[model samples]
Target: MNEQDVYDAIVTRRSTRNYKPTPVEPQKLARIIDAGRYAPSGGNSQTNRFFVVQKQEIIADLIKLVEEAFSKMDVYDGMYRSLRNSILRSKEGGYLFCYNAPVLVVVANKKDYGNNMADCAVAIENMMVEANALDLGSCWINQLRWLNEEPTLLEYMRKLGLPEDERVYGAAIFGYPATEDGKPNRVPLPRTGVDVVYL
Candidate 1:
């Protein structure tokens, strides 16, 4: 790969909310997951666990459970905007957290690990970039991580193979874009907030 190709992938990757029901190709999916696995980890622990969910029934159940959990909670005045929206829509009935994507790669790590979230975040970013390179649409799903300790969600997660000592830190949902041309939008969103300092 050319040097500019990596930079291009990083710049053009965008959060994809709408996805087609079409399943991702097995080879492409494998390569994306591989990118995630190759991400750096604290002390080279490489302990992050990835759970790739592709079963429609299980995905539907997860959506229903997450919606039910969020709907039962009360929103506060200073809550984060995206989370607030989730709580509101969940109460309104249907709330597909994964946007109906065919594949949801749930990342988990030891709860007591100091760098769990950071490690998971790096992995997710790597996977997202790889997904974009493969012409797949991908989005980071945070609702599961927010409710990582909730009883109902924990129960379901355990059933799906999450160990007792592990908690979800992040997730990436992947699928083909719903666009007419079947290509993911690669237009880079303008940067207006990040500040850099020179030493």
Candidate 2:
């Protein structure tokens, strides 16, 4: 992709929270993951481990565990609005965090590393842009990272190849858009808080 293409992709990337029950092409998935792997790491540590999951069974199992975990928690004042919603929705039964996207990419890194989360965030953003370029809808899934330290979740994650010393820092769900036009909503919103300073 050229510079303009990259810029266009970034401009059009939007948070897609809904997806159809369709699988992504294997080669496109590989390209998205490759974009993540090429993301810059702090000091080039390259410690981020990307777990790409496409199996619906595994995704369903994870969703069940996530709902159960959220259901056990109490919503507190000042908590993130989305998390509070997750808890309430889980209690009502049927809470799919990834919006049923066919591809779930969880980025994990050493828990103690100062730049672990930062690196993971970069990788996720890279893949999100790549997904946009490929005309796929993508959304950031933060619930998993929020529950990274929960004992039950940790154990299950370990069984899925998450190292004992590692924890999820970020994740992204990607697949074809479920919209009628089959394209992600790309109209940019006004920049409100990202203030700029002139040197």
Candidate 3:
């Protein structure tokens, strides 16, 4: 790809919440995961593990567990807006954190690592950009990470191969778009709040 293509992918990538049931192509999925693995890691630790979940049964179970966990929580004043929204929707039932995407790439890192979250974040961003380049829709899912320490979730994750010394830091859902054109929305949202000061 050319420079302009890379820039366009970076700018046009958006958080895709709705996705088609069609699974992502294996080649494209491999490339997307490769991009994530190529992301720079702090001190070259390179300990981030990727869990690519594509089984419908497993995904369904995860969604159910997440909803159950959130539903049992009590909303409070000054709570994070997205967390509050999650809790409310979960209580109402049928809250799909991955938006029913066919594939969810869960990024995990050493629980005690100082740069765990940062490393996982960089990987996720790389994967999202790659997904956009491949014409695949992707969304960052945070509910698992938010409940990383919950016993129910931890047990489930362990069954899914999550190591005892590791915790989920981030996740990205991937699949084809459900739009009429079968393409992800590419229109860039205007940014007005990011300030920059040249050193």
Candidate 4:
């Protein structure tokens, strides 16, 4: 692997919603997941599960199931903004949550684990940074986690080998960017809202 600044990769890793049909190389994808597997876990649980889905049919089915599940939901006041948006968009039709990325990595952890979400978040962050370093466009996908508890989704995921005691906490889609130059959009978006007051 060519040397790329880790801090640079972390800072420039933009969420790439639009992707080319090109798939990530098998080796690079392996490395991406490896990066996640190395993330620290609560009690060193190391219980995170990764479902690397590249099959078109499986991804298509997942999209359909997610849209179907979201379309039936009602948005409520104080609801998580993204979840509400997913529901509204699903109701309107044609919601491809993964942005047509050629590869999707679904992250799951023990449902009863107190640090499930935190562990999953760190894992996703590692994968995203690794993808950025490997020149793959990646985005954190939350829809799957939102639907993790839905019966239909749970059943379908189990059919795909998800253990009965675990639930999806996060997912990510990675592929070549659709940008004209075929590189991740590295334009810096200055962070303005993460307030920091040093003590």
Against the true structure, candidate 1 reaches a TM-score of: 0.98
What TM-score does candidate 4 reach? 0.96
The positional error of residue 78 in candidate 4, measured at the CA in angstroms, is: 3.2
Clashing residue pairs, backbone N/CA/C < 3 A, model 1: none
Give candidate 1 misplaced runs (Cα > 4 Å): none
Models 1 onward score TM values of: 0.98, 0.96, 0.98, 0.96
- 1-199: candidate 4 lDDT, tens digit per residue: 4455988998899999999998788999999999999999999999999999999999999999999999999999999999999999999999999999999999999999999999999999999999998989999999999999999999999999999999999999999999999999998799879999999
What clash pairs does model 3 have?
A: none
Clashes by residue pair, model 4: none
Q: lDDT at 28 for candidate 3?
A: 95
Regions of model 4 farther than 4 Å from truth = 1-4
Residue 111 lDDT, candidate 3, scale 0-100: 100
Estimate the TM-score for candidate 3: 0.98
- Cα lDDT tens digits, model 2, 1-199, are 4899989999889999888878999999999999999999999999999999998888898899999999999999999899999999999999989998999999999999999999999999999999999999999999999899988888988999999999999999999989998888787787889898999
Location of the lowest summed lDDT over 10 successive residues in candidate 4: 1-10
lDDT values, one for every candidate: 0.94, 0.93, 0.94, 0.95
Q: Which tens-of-lDDT digit does each residue in 1-199 have in candidate 3? A: 4999999999999988888999888999999999999999999999999999999999999999999999999999999999999999999998988898999999999999999999999999999999999999998999999999999999999998998999999999999988999899999889998989999
Better TM-score candidate (2, 3): 3
